[model samples]
Target: MPQRSAVSSATETERKYTAADSGSLPDLAGLPRVAGIDVDTVELSAQYYDTADLRLLQSKITLRRREGGDDAGWHVKLPGGVDTRTELHFPLDGAGASSDEPPAELMNLLLGVRRGMPVSLAALLTTSRHRHRLQGSDGTLLAEVVEDDVVAVRGSDGAEVNWREIEVEIAPSAGSHDMATLFEAIEQRLAAGGISRSFSPSKVHRVLGDLLPAAPELAEGARYLRDYLVHELHTLDLSDIAVRRNEPDAVHSMRKASRRIRSAVQTYAADFGLDEALVDELRWFGRRLSPSRDLEVQWERLAERVSEIPVDPYREATKTRIDEYFSAKSETARIEALAALDSQRYLSLLHSLDTLVDELGKTLPARRRKSELNPEKLAQSVAAVAKNVDKRVARVLKADDPHERDERMHRARKGAKRMRYAIEVIAPLHPKRTTRILARFDDFQDMLGEFQDSVVSREHLLDILSEQGHAAESSFGLGILYRLEGEIGRQQAAHLEPAWKKALRSAEKLWA
Candidate 1:
């Protein structure tokens, strides 16, 4: 059986003043009362692990076996807010006990990844750490000493271990000055030891760990298309996590991610092997999630706006209506979105997306070249994405009913974002053209977004009023909010027309 528990503790301390000009430690004058002896020491070697895709490392999990410290052992640092690492300790002899497999407690942390694939033993390193402590204004025990670490890494193949060092810190007090003092003190100490600041960004890199391949160098057309596709896939993955967590704005965020991915994939059909039917299905799923997400954003926005309005004759009534509408809609939308996520189709889509990403990663290498960005090709690609957005918007405009119109409009907003992102990814390649295109796209997206929000808020208000019994006096406020949303929608539509024309023109000039 594995021992599993969380111990909560608070830390507070300050580091002594360091040299003013050198940013190094100064002598401690009237150091505060030390309640306990804290050793300012250094730790040298630490190993890290991850999956083939660098999951654990990306998530900031560190597994290391260290020597030369009083608390040295096998340490698995879990992610949390502060430098407060959940240190799991073991004797040096205990190394082989879990060498072949991860402990059960650690397994829970990697639940998102599939089981049975051996956790890749990625990299090994030696880290040197210097420690320090701080006291309160009065001579009283506040926090313990901190550590500055210098690391040397043995490559994955047991080649050479490159040496680098960084500071691993903890505070005795929450104050920033104390932290700064400790940092200065440690730097001075390390400088005296002939250790300098490491040029490596992270200890993992210093060790020569496996890294994701750099983005392919492609022609302007291919690069824009590739990055656009990659962004969509990335968004989909983000939404998956948000959906699984059931976060407050998860549905909306997930829906946006999905729509963006689908739109981009569809627009750049020649660049990727996505099935049109599959993309259509994803659009359907996004539509299902939109109402709740839209309602949430709308209410939050309108609530703020309404608060700014003076106490007019209808101010109180408007607030009441908006409140009632959102309360009921939020509940219903959440329930529906969760149910949709549980469907087999949704699962299948997720699997398909994962497969698509792998396929793209494999195939893109063949089509790419190592060179500068081509302006004309990038402009053409942006035009393609914008045209896709135009089509989506046209479909939404054709929808007769409010529900259908709102749903399609949400999809259009996603299409606009993808178009925007496509231009953004290649902005470096064709700075002038991409900038102008992005600016216009942003305006179009903002208006559509506002319209969607109003639609969602109104729905939520209606739901609330319905549930609370729609008596004239009881639910009168909901009606006012709904009316306000309708007005807002009209205004948003009026604003969007000229923005669309400008964006279309920008794309054409570049493409031409």
Candidate 2:
């Protein structure tokens, strides 16, 4: 309901290249399952727009209004990688299709990037394209290879530039075709011609390189932690986008990102200026996301375990109760979480994260070289987390009473998660060893998670029975459900020991 009209979007996955050699054309003819290569050509023109300071460019995003070819209108491209971008399109508005002013909906999508900055015309590009389409035997389109001759003019500066490149666009929705093989074969043909892949992100980047921000100069410890923080922030942003679209697993993914961000700051706070208040705020954000995610987990779990209940009118009544509760709780939780994300508070938090790396870079900018990394110091910092994991795991293993064991295992799970995230940060430094250590502890954490879930499920099931009020059949069905959950818990308990031992041994070796 944010927009009156639908926001049309698709994943744009394509590779751009400069050359494909001169001597002989590659065998781009009919390959396996391919019907033929159909050739055609077209002329395309686009006007790119952005903030005066190039805020959108800094974020590797582009908003353009174009004419010609099959798809035309205003397009917003979010750069994901060398060949991946999330593209959203809106039909051209009648008032000013080529006006400096952007559509209101497109402006809304760029709020996270623009942060209230004013936008204007950045550049204009025109291309004469010769396209080759690969199609399947049944006339299904596969990929489009286009040779583009381009001319670009900067809007403000009046500077002009031109270039030619080959762009291979795989039909992202097509999975039945062997696109990967076709891509590799194309690359091989180009490689044989002594053509190298283009390094520029896009034609716009090539023309306006001076406007983009320079890479941060960072210290060794700062480098590791900065990358960790940026990654978590990226996940956080992506998850928020998914949640806004009402996509699956968005809340869970967002929660995990918040947790990872919190853990990273806790593990290496001094490297950045991360303090206690900020950590508390992250925890607050995670808590806001948790209610929705937990309700989702409970709803799915109770439905799954209903099979264990004895088949009777009691079972039917329980199912109805569960459904009604789930419907109300889930709707409220979703609304609450979305409301928080759209609040000014969340927007301010995002703006703060926008310059997180550069701000950290200023802390210890003196050491720019790899030789400055103190291996012994790095090892000690890593070992501190590993030691914490070991202590928690040991407490869980030693606990005798059920209550004591559950409490210890809960602590152990949190510690293990923190350690696993820390290891992932340093995995490139010690890939083989860290990979082994991570797997062992991850298994241990997952087992404890299942055990804890079973405990909560049992209580919630009992609450359902208690609400039935004087119904004998309901009590009997609830008893069966509770016992089944207890048995499941026992099964998980049986699977825990070997994983614990394996994790303990691996944790010790990580420090070794």
Candidate 3:
């Protein structure tokens, strides 16, 4: 087998400032810590890579390979919290360094963002740097301040630009609170000398100039629905990246984003003249993600419930069975989810969404435009969805057969979900009222969800028990689990009426 590519990670916390050609780092000889300073200089050259459309730069991410630097190698930078970025470094080795393509290891982490798009050289930059290491009296490094003169050449147009900047980065040894104070002091000190923070997030962003899309802003002619669509699209992008990173709640969040967009489209379908095909595709995408997220929820719930079983051997056997089954199934489901994300269908869906957002943002003659959103009409639409949910709930209540009621309850839960999503779409227009209604609906939904989960759990337990197994103890344990789920389902069903009444009361506030 080929050896795995070596990788290391670091978090960069720094502020960048632009200055005049003659400007440079100012004096800090008598700052708060009375630290001594050490100075050094280095030269560096880096080749940045991205898709032809500069997708990475648009997302505030960067991929590069640098030579002549102490940490020379391939690097991937991801936007983090305020004034911070996470950097992953891969050593120059094997075919990765010699070849033009980025290493497979680093590329895998960006699968969500790139979505199988090809990456190529975007820009080349060289920097001449003067570095100052600030240290405490005891020789502990507090921060590193650097002054850089940078020259960049765009790979596309052979356009060259040169500038000077300063960076102040907090050292690992510095306390978080102390670093905040020190950074502010540095900022104020620089301001006194006519230096200010750069508007550009990175060198690549500045270099790309007009090549990237303009960041969306709310201004005149901006429709609320258009802004909402943009926000959901961005949320989908972040969720995609998180899913690739295998981060917690990534699959769940992505599914939620997909659902919100789909429901928003449906809620405004008549007004916007939106395409039904886009809604269908969104549903398809969410369905592809459902297996992984559903299994994840089931596993956590089962494992937690099993842990509460105080009995020995039976408890242990039940726990082991749940763990083994879920582990195998979750892995398979995750593989399928990733495969879906890599599919051409997914790319087509994204393009459709992009086109829809673009059309929504345009200004057109009234005759050409489909319609505009009116808050009163939107409230009526929301009420219609909620009324449908109420009908489903009534059907569940009227069902005499247990199996039929269970099925009807599941359908009611789905309707409730749709109603909640519709309310969320118009939430910005009436935050207080929508917030109240949503909270109540959430409680109602939770009860229904619990009942539905129990139904699924019982089915799973029955299947496992029917399978041939060695120990009577294991079979008995699964039998107990089935009984537990059955009882919980009954209890949740009993509680549904009260939850629905409470939700109904709060929902009235939407139009009141």
Candidate 4:
């Protein structure tokens, strides 16, 4: 078996500033609880790597092989929060030190971001650092302030640029609140010397200027939709990370993001070049991740209802068995979900979205037989969906048969998703009205979702009970829960009419 490296990481929250010289590095003794400053100096050499087009850079991810630092190793930094990035470090091994090939473990972790692209060394940078460790009276380390004098050499050209910068790196234990105050105090001390936070996103970005995509001339609608699409893509990628780590809500969030992306695609079908086949492929993942969540929901609802009645040992034992069954099934589903995200096909989806965003950002001419959709026309689509939603609403309200009502309600739910996604893409343009409509859709979708869940729970319960080897109480308890689901479902059905009527009536001429 190939040695698998355990995933190791730290939250790196730091601020950077460009300086003319490190001769004026700030003294930390003035900050709160500072006892003394311990100074350390080191010579650091590192080589940064990225894809040919710099996909990793575009995503704000950095991979580097470095030496001379106390904890020198291979580092992969992923964009996290405000001034925070998740830094993963691997020991400097033969492959990384001798050449630029990153380890397999690190490469697998980045499959979602790299999308099968080859990574090449981009820049060679050497830094002379003057590190100041701020310590409290009690000897608690507060923060590390580094003054870096950097010389960057472009890999393509032998051109070298020399500069100096200041970095304020907070101790992980210092916490965000302390970090913020300390950072600001340091900022103020530096600002007095005619220095401010650097505008450049990263040292690599400053060195490899113009290699990444430039600012684009996207139209208002295209820009709004593209921003949303990019957000969903990020959400999807984060969910992938969560899934790999076995986070509780990963599959559920990923599935919801995929559904929203599909809805947005339909709302802006004419906006830009989008792949229909790719959309279908996305749906596969949502379905794959679904069984676990669906079963979890059913298990909770059924158990809650069954627990309300008098306890029965027979039913208790049966419940344990059912729980075991669902638990095993959910685990299997989770494995499948992870597999799908790691698959070649799913990697292609990320690549496709990257391409779509790139093409949409080009100089204004539509491609793939789709025209440039006007921003104002988005309102017209809203009005059209409103009209169709009203029809679907009325059909669900009038349907008498339970089976038929569910089918119509399902269609109505889809209509609600379409309308809400349309407005969501442009909510900032007309916040007040679109915001109100989206809220109404939220309530309507929830009701429909509840009904659908009850239906699924019923089917699952019946199927489970029909299997061989059941005690009287097992049958009795499950049957009671099953009937209660039907009853509760009927109650929800009765309110569908009023819910639809109110949502549709509140938004008059949706376009207006």
Q: TM-scores of all models?
A: 0.66, 0.83, 0.88, 0.87
Query: Best by lDDT, which number?
Result: 3
Give the lowest summed-lDDT range of ten residues in model 1.
12-21
Off by over 4 Å in 4: 1-5, 93-99, 271-275, 292-319, 363-372, 463-484, 506-509
| Two-way TM-score contest, 2 vs 4, winner | 4
Segments of candidate 1 deviating more than 4 angstroms: 1-38, 42-49, 58-128, 134-164, 168-208, 211-220, 224-255, 272-292, 302-375, 385-415, 468-473
Q: Candidate 2: lDDT of 288?
A: 85
lDDT of each: 0.58, 0.74, 0.82, 0.78
Q: What does candidate 4's lDDT look like per residue over 139-168, in tens digits?
A: 888888889999999887768989999888
Ranking by TM-score: 3, 4, 2, 1
lDDT of 2 by residue, 199-305 (tens): 88777887787877666776656677777777787677667766766778889998998888777767766534566466677778888888888888888887777
**In every candidate, how many clashes are there?**
33, 0, 0, 0
Which residue pairs in model 2 clash with each other? none
Error of 3 at 486 (Å): 2.8
Q: In candidate 3, what are the lDDT values of residues 26-68, reduced to their tens digit? A: 7878776846999999999999999888877866889998887
User: 1-512, model 1: which lDDT tens digit per residue?
Assistant: 63333312233222222212224333333333333434466555555656666645544555555556665555555434444443455445452435435454344333433222346566665554454444555534444443343435443456655332334343444355655555555456556645555454346654543465565444555545556656555545445444545556657667766766675566555544456776788778887887777767777876765644444545566666667667887778877876776666676776666666555545434345432234454456667777877888788768888678778777777667777755665566667866777787777777887887787667666666666444564345456566778888878866655677777787676667
